[model samples]
Target: MTLFTVDPATVTPAPFTDDDWAFTLLRCLASPSTEEYPPARLCGFLFLAPDRLRLYFGTEPDLPGTTAADVRPGGALTALLAALPSLLDEQRLTKTDTDDPHCSRVVDLTGW
Candidate 1:
């Protein structure tokens, strides 16, 4: 698993509310990447605390590994998020079907 710690102060508009945090997260995850290859697929949980936010990426259902800049909030964070989804694609990782119930349950829950 990979953990990304974000400093709230650096995030523009500063996520002060639950809704704001959700929106910021979605926006970052949906932002466009500046890469020519596809981004990696991220499957994990997001933990929001009173002081900061944590993005925990798991290595199941999909391969791991992602590249990011300094990840300063705002633009840099968005770029990093956008780049994650295309990592596996860029590496030409193949998606295989699984029969494990636990794995299937995870995939179903995450809709990955």
Candidate 2:
């Protein structure tokens, strides 16, 4: 019987705004029983102008390229939270960092 505790402030969702970029922290898990849905969760933050998104999954995350088309889905946290449903719909899955006990995930809100 263990309860998880992440600072409420850290988990808090940002407001939906036009200029916000979504920085999602996805933890991909493997299904043992071959479940169709698999197990996953979406944890992340949003960034506005003068702010940006940076993520570290032990390894560095891929920054957006020059093309906005490829960068839209991975925008600021505010934008991501607002369009979370759509990202899930498009990707057809969600992931959580809890799947791994030793995995350290860091999402940095920097330049936007």
Q: Please report the candidate that would top lDDT against the real structure.
A: 1
Could you say which candidate leads in TM-score? 1
- Estimate the lDDT of model 1: 0.37
- Poorest lDDT segment (10 consecutive residues) of candidate 1: 103-112
TM-scores for every predicted model: 0.29, 0.18
What clash count does candidate 2 reach? 16
Candidate 1: C-alpha RMSD after superposition:
14.2
- Report the C-alpha lDDT of model 1 over 35-94, residue by residue, as the tens digit: 443233233333334423333334433543322211223333444454544442332223
- RMSD list, candidates in order: 14.2, 14.9
List candidate 1 stretches off by more than 4 Å: 1-19, 30-38, 58-112
Steric overlap count per candidate: 8, 16
